[model samples]
Target chain A: MSLPLLEVDDLHVTFNTASGPVHAVDGVSFTMESGDSLGVVGESGSGKSVTARALLRLFAITDDVRIAGSVRFDGVDLLRIDERKLRDVRGGQIGMIFQDPLTSLNPLMAVGEQIAESLRLHRGMGRSEAAAEAVELLGRVGIADPERRATELPNSFSGGMRQRVMISLAIACRPRLLIADEPTTALDVTVQAEILLLLDELRRSEQMALMLITHDFGVVAATCEDVQVMYAGRLVEKASMVHLFDRANHPYTEGLLRLVPRFEDAHTGRLHPIAGQPPITGGGGSSCAFAPRCSHAFDRCRSEVPPEVAVGPQHLSACWLAAERAKDATEAGRPWKRDP
Target chain B: MSAAAARAVLEVSDAVVEFDTDGGRITAVDGVSLQLSTGETLGLVGESGCGKSTLARAILQLVPMQQGSVRLEDTDLGSLSPRELRRMRHRIQMVFQDPRGSLDPRMSVTALIGEPLRVHGIGDRASRAREVAEAMELVGLPALVADRLPSELSGGQQQRVGIARAIVTDPAVLVCDEPVSALDVSIQAQIINVLDELRDTLNLAMLFIAHDLSVVRHLSDRVAVMYLGQFVETGTASEVFTEPRHPYTQGLITSVPRADTESAARLQTARRLVLGELPSLLDPPSGCRYRTRCPYATDRCADVEPPPDLLDGHHAVRCHHHRAITAGEHQPSSKSMRG
Candidate 1:
């Protein structure tokens, strides 16, 4: 098989804080084929965003920061690439859209200038050519009257309009990969739906692989093919969208799925909130980080870290319960899966 | 006091709050009316600029309403002097959105919870100390952390402290404005569960305002869909979810992705979206505030605003074509902009 467009293997990112080394993105490994979408789903401090940011070596400048393992994109090691080369890769090969479009865009410059800046720098387009291209890109992303709207300051644009501009800039260079970190978190629900649809359309037409980093599971289900559930810093579960939902192995994943209020079904029981806060990463060593919060934790979970074992073909879960309850998933008509 | 006033712990009618800005006057909370009975939750769901927060503030008399009546139990809050208002505030407490911001950074958890009791003159120092421990235990926090500051607590813990402080006075009405929106999904459930339990134990009347309708459904006995500066729909939670009358309500509900696996699958298919420029409420539409983005908006809508008239005894909708929309007779030109 051809090499995946992006391969993240055994990635680890740690930050040195006063208390101890904050282990964010611990041993996260995943691969996305060209045009494939992978969603990194996690709660706050779960390292999803850190994993996405590390691809661009965003942590390198910060002091006492450590990042290990490999992030291969189009046969180049993103982690090892020099700043000069990485600059080319940044807008030319990979683009990023962060949450809060209000803060992401430059207030001093017109919105068009920001989009054209990327095109001019990355593709070496002339000023006029980039400006024309920027308007078309804006229109392509569903912004109305893009030609005029392009010249207006970001403050003039609505929240939804600003987000569309952010998306326009991220896709201006026609990058191979786009990392969107909660692109719609700050947007209204109606606007979020439109943005999600716009991104899906862009992904399909451009054949760009997407790394969607969001805490919202529904957004992942709508946009991604492959899903990775992060807990503490480790990838607790990784599977296709269907497998993640239908035969989720990790207790955390199941609890997460159950906790969300759904309009489609009548949720009569008290919401089953996972007991206790997410464990603060530091000072603790070698044990399952999720053990203390996990309801199914046993002596084995506390003493030794469980290795990721396959529950289904290509579906892996890093929980001791996955080994014990492998038959449970298959019994629920998920016959393709096996007990680890 | 009317007989209905006896039942409703907090009642607001024709509440209108406006702010004078450099551009013009902005009506943050339009002529809106709502009531909350003891142990009942009336969830106000809306987008950021839709005045849900402003309405909550208006109800609490935190902000003065230019034209409205806020009756807390038998007392008319607007007529009260500042001194009397301060004295009356103990009857109705507010839980703010940001736990960190609402709580004083310098105060210990003990001091934070005890402040309300001390302000209300509910108990003596020793009794207040005993009550502070009781409040901590009620919200599931250990008594040992009473001395700890708000900064030392996690997001969920801080929210629990916020909840504990709101409930410490045993206020009859609780106006929680997006209390759990800042928390994680798992932690959101824990907070929701805690509030749900507290509602039963305290028999409190709550006005829960949040943007997420799903969370509102879990907690609210009734739901009000707000847009711009006005509510377009109000009904029982099940009624609003299952058979929404207004197109804006339809679009809003359809937009949120449910956690169920089937919803994800359903989301893959083509869907209608309610999207148009949300008009500046500074110069809002002549009639319906949502008329600009509304799919079923007609010339009549521009001429006059549709009042939220009750359909059955409980369900109310402020739409010209609500009945037709629910009957599947009024087919919007853009089917996706159902709300």
Candidate 2:
């Protein structure tokens, strides 16, 4: 079989705080094939962004951080790569689009110069060639009057337009994989839709693997084909997009889905909010992290971590209740009932 | 109707706000009018730079208006003296979007919620504490959180405190400006539920403003869609969202990612009506503000402004091509209606 574009196995990331060591990412594993889209979804502080950063080794992991995992891309181990090689792989092979375009783009430089710099460094193109490619990239991403916009500073562009510039910069070298972390959070709904469509078109045209990190499931439902649900630094569920929406095995996923407002819902009613906050991790050798807020928690769930249970052809969930529910539904010849 | 029964909690008529910037004169709000009946919820939705927040600030008399009038139960807001306006402030309150920025950093939650009651001279120290506790409970915040600072609480908890402060004075009207936009999806649900419960118990007439069409669709009794500085469409939430008449309104609704089975295909087919960047408020386009991006734009669209066409008793849209657009006569090749 062909090798996956990216594969992360048993990844663990920890942070040292005054109180103790915070286990940010614990035993998260997933793989993305070429041209496949995977969504990493969770609330803030759930380690979704941390996991994305870990792929590129962006975080400052001093003596405080204890990273124990293997991240392999294109049959090469990323975690063990040297600094010079890692630098080459970071922007050349893998590109990342951050949450805020205003902060990501340099205020002092012209938008075209920045994209040209990326092209020159990664692709080793000459200055004049890079300038032409920069404008072409800008136009490719649907920026109007790209030649003029390329020379303009980022401050002149709106948030949506700046985001388009960021995308142009990210894809300047034509990386094999692109990681987008809440790229549209700062945009309005209409602009957000346009950006999403643009990303979808680019992904299809380039056949590049995409790892979209977002808290908004609506975004994932719109673009992603595969999804991984994270909770309190652990991967709770992994499934195909269709299966996850049709039968969300994890309780946290169900709660999240219910929380999203639907058009058909009554205008005024009590929303069913998940009670209690996510637990704070003090160390790395703990049990299941979501035990505190999970309604399906049992004695074992509190003391011992549950193993990944297969739910469908490629779907897996780390919950005792999910396995039982799946079996019950299968035996009864009925689909799993969703909680309203 | 009896005098007591007929009093509107807040009424705004022909309200217009303009700003003089370096570029030119900008009409942020133009002839926009609305009324807040007691114990009613009105949701205002639009894309960014649509002047929804400007209209909210105008009602609170925070933003100076060039023309129009605001009345709180027959008291002319524009005519009120400075002292009279200060006295009238107790009857109406506002909750801002950023809870962390809105609340005082140095103050504890107790002090923040208690400030309004103290300013209004509603009760003594002991009674004030009791009232604070009651307000906390009303917003579903635990009493123990009263001692915490805004930074110590989570986003959802901080917003509850914001609501508690707004409702502490028993104001007849509450203007929530995107109260839950900064929160998590689950936390947004909690805050929305708290607002719903508070409205029913306290009989609050709320002016809810948000950019998310889905959230507004699930929260508002009547929804108004704004474009540039004008109201493009206004109707009951169900009518406006389900059967939008204005091209801008229909475009906004179709843009939201729905959970229907056909959403994927419909998303591909829906035409993006609004294009380019929002026009600079300092020099808005003449005639129809949306004419710059409208697909069905004609020569007349740039010369004559389209008046609000009454689609139904409660529905209205301001668009010259509303009939052709809504009737599917000039429908785009890819338009599909998803749930």
Candidate 3:
């Protein structure tokens, strides 16, 4: 079989601060085939965004921060590559969009020129041709008047419009993979729908792989085909979209699924909020990180780290409960009913 | 009707607030009338520029309404002198979206919660200290948090401090503007629960403003949908959310992404694509502000605006095509209705 488009193995990112070493991303590993869409769902400080950034090596290089892992893209290890080669790979092979477009874009530069700069740098397109292509991209992203908007500064554009501009800039090179970090969080629900639709369209038409990092599962359900649930800087569960939703194995994943309020559950009375906040990452130990907040946490969970084991075909969960279930099934020589 | 009128603690009539922008006069809240009875929660839902926040500010009397009469317990705030309004401010309080931004970073938690009591000059040093500690405990904060700065607390803790400050004076009406939007999902539930419990036990009138339809539905006894500076629909939460009449309100109901598997499945099966974004408030459409993005726009919709129609004595909708639309006439495009 052909190798996967991108494979991240034992990826770890740590920040050394006055408090201690903050292990922002603690040993995350996943693989994405060509044209596949993977979602990383978690709350803030869950290390989803940090993991995505590590794929592109976007964090500032410094003595305070330690990054150790293997990120193989197109048969080449991105982590081992030089900075110059990585820069070439970033805009050409992988493009990223952020939650806030205004902060990402330069206020002084015209919207069109900002996007055109990428085309010139990556594809070496001439000035006029790049400018024309930028306008075309703006129009493709559903802008009402692309020709005029291309000349406007970032300040003149609305939030949704600015987001569209950011999308255009990202897709200017038509990269193989796109990392969208809460791309629609700042927009209205209606506007968010439109943006998601655009991203879906781009994914299909370009056969582009996507790493969608977001807190909202609804957004992920709409966009991603494969799902990975992260908590306390670790990937607790990874499975196909259908399996992950129906058979949520990890207690943390299950807690998040039930915690978020739904429109239909308007009068359902009392949301099941996960008690207490997520623990601070980077604590040295073999103990389970989520034991404090998990309802299914046991004595073993508090002292020993659970290895990710196959709960179902192609579905993996890192929880002692899953291990217990597997042990019971093997001992009984038949499948056993899981507790509710 | 008589009972509601008798129990009404806050009444706003023909409220109009205009801003003098470079683009000329923009009416943020226009001719909106509403009544808030004692211990009732009124949820105001709208998109970003629909003027929900402006209406909240107008009711708080923070900004001068160009023309309107705001009566709090039969006292017209417009007629009150500056000093008189200041004296009356203690009974009315607000909780803002950003807990940290709304609170003073320099002040300790105790000082922040006690400032309202001090300004009203209700208690002496010893009594105020007792009251401050009580308020902190009331909102589920520990006594030790009183000495910490605003920055030292988490988002949820900061919001509790905010709620404590608002209720310390025992305000008759409390206006919360997107109180939980900045918080995480679990924390959001905690804050929402606190607000709901406080409203019920304290018998306080509340105007809960939020863009999230789900949260508003949970908290509000009555709900109002605003579009381009006007109240398009208002009714009991169940009636308004379940049987939304206004097209704008319907779009909001069907657009929200839900978490429950049943609704998510239903949404996936019957998901409708919602149309365009809200137009700029600077140049609103003639007659019907929503018509620009509305799918059922007709000649009448553009020519003359339909006046508000009251149904079942409580439910109100402002749309000429609401009846036909509700009857499934001129079926909405697959684009806007999800579930």
The candidate that achieves the highest DockQ relative to the unseen native structure: 2
Model 1 Cα shift for residue B185 (angstroms): 2.4
Better of 1 and 3 by lDDT: 3
lDDT of 3 by residue, A160-271 (tens): 8889999999999999899999998878776776677678779989999998998887777777888898887899899887666666777788788777666665556666
RMSD values for the candidates in order, in angstroms, are 3.2, 3.0, 3.7
Per model, how much of the real contact set is kept? 0.54, 0.58, 0.38
Q: Chain A TM-score for model 3, please?
A: 0.93
Which structure is stronger by DockQ: 1 or 3? Answer: 1
Tell me the RMSD of model 3 versus the true structure: 3.7
Considering the two chains of model 3, state its CAPRI-style docking category. Answer: acceptable
| Candidate 1, TM-score of its B chain | 0.93
TM-score for candidate 2, please give it: 0.95
For each candidate, what's the DockQ? 0.51, 0.60, 0.43
Model 2, residue B251: displacement in angstroms? 0.8
Tens digits of per-residue lDDT, candidate 2, B64-160, equal: 9999999887788899998889888878999989999999988999999999999888889999999999999899888787788898998888999
lDDT of 1 by residue, A1-340 (tens): 7788998898988888888888877888888877888888877878888889888887655557888999999878899988899999987789888899877789988999999998999999999999999999999988889999999999988888899999999999998999999998878777787788778778889999988999888888778888999888888899998777678888878777777675565436588777776767731358888888887899988999888999987789998889666678767754222222
Q: After aligning candidate 1 to the native by TM-score, how far in Å is the CA of B56 from where it should be?
A: 0.8
* C-alpha lDDT of residue A61 in model 1: 59
